[model samples]
Target: MENDEMIIPELNNETIESMIYIIRGQKVILDFELAKIYGYETKRFNEQVKNNINKFPERYRFQLNKEELDIILRPKKSTLAKRILKNI
Candidate 1:
């Protein structure tokens, strides 16, 4: 089978900019935000990543530590989990 490059959808500049944040002193966007920008369901996006794991570097993804999660989750007036559920 001939290999074909997958085309990533164009993202709105403002929308993409807004999703970027500094976490652990590194600029990043959550998997969910990236999936949204790429017009994918978060679960499917993640599954694709797993299937093509070698395509991404270690720094490309990391789980939030407890302290980091607390710092982020605490400030949000609303529960992030609920917000995520509503969107999906």
Candidate 2:
């Protein structure tokens, strides 16, 4: 294998089950995790999904409360909100 090569894991029941996360009573799979299963970079995977975002019934969306928004808009340079805000 070359330095740039990747080894895709087998998607058996256990592997898929391990990727599923339960948050707030809802099952979720992060896009980066899903992209890894198919051997695609996260940006490429997201671009493809963005082209057809509404096609899937299981697509997830969430709304932040006022307190959540306030935290995300904090002006500290080292805060995690910079990355989180970009994704929002």
Candidate 3:
């Protein structure tokens, strides 16, 4: 195989599985993790999502409330909130 044919080693089934979470009783992946998969920074990826918001319907995307966050996240609520705020 040519050097260009070599697979990128960082991507694996285990890593992909690790990024998925159950939120609001749905299996979902966060924007930052999706951004990494697509080789874009989180902010840039979110900007694209915002620009194309109409293309994504309600079933496709939604924000979490504090109650949903508590159920989905294992970390302390304050710690996760701080991390989320930093990403925003």
Candidate 4:
């Protein structure tokens, strides 16, 4: 079958790679990234997560520490700061 016939949606390699990195044994997504993907604002994404804290266990979701945040945002800023600041 041709490549276009593949069942998986066609995504750019960078996006696929980012997904792989994000899903590395953890259900985590930065607020900005999740907002972009879900078509919501970053603040709204954080509000939902906060409202449904139980739905997001540590394994499913958690905020990054300053060091961790530094690592993630060093290359580029992420809206995760909103939640991280609150969680801390």
For model 4, the run of ten residues with the poorest summed lDDT = 1-10
* Candidate 2 structure quality by residue, lDDT tens digits, 1-88: 1123344557778878865655556776656556666666667767768787786445384434676446434543364455444444
lDDT of 4 by residue, 1-88 (tens): 1122323345466775574334345646576665555655567767888999888776767666777657765555555455445534
Best by TM-score: 1
Candidate 1, residue 8: Cα displacement in angstroms equals 13
Off by over 4 Å in 3: 1-9, 70-86
**What C-alpha RMSD separates each model from the true structure?**
5.6, 7.6, 6.1, 9.2
Write model 3 residue lDDT over 4-87, tens digit each, in one string. Answer: 232335878887887678876788887766765776666887888999989878797888777776675666457655655676
TM-score of each: 0.68, 0.52, 0.66, 0.56
Q: Relative to the true structure, how large is the alpha-carbon lDDT of every model?
A: 0.70, 0.58, 0.70, 0.59
Please list the residue runs of candidate 1 whose C-alpha ends up more than 4 Å from where it truly belongs after superposition: 1-11, 74-80, 86-88
In candidate 4, position 36 carries an lDDT of: 54
Instruction: Residues 1-88, candidate 1: write the lDDT tens digits.
Output: 1123323455567767866778988988877777665666677788889999999888888878877766665666386656566557
Whichever of 2 and 3 has more TM-score, that candidate is 3
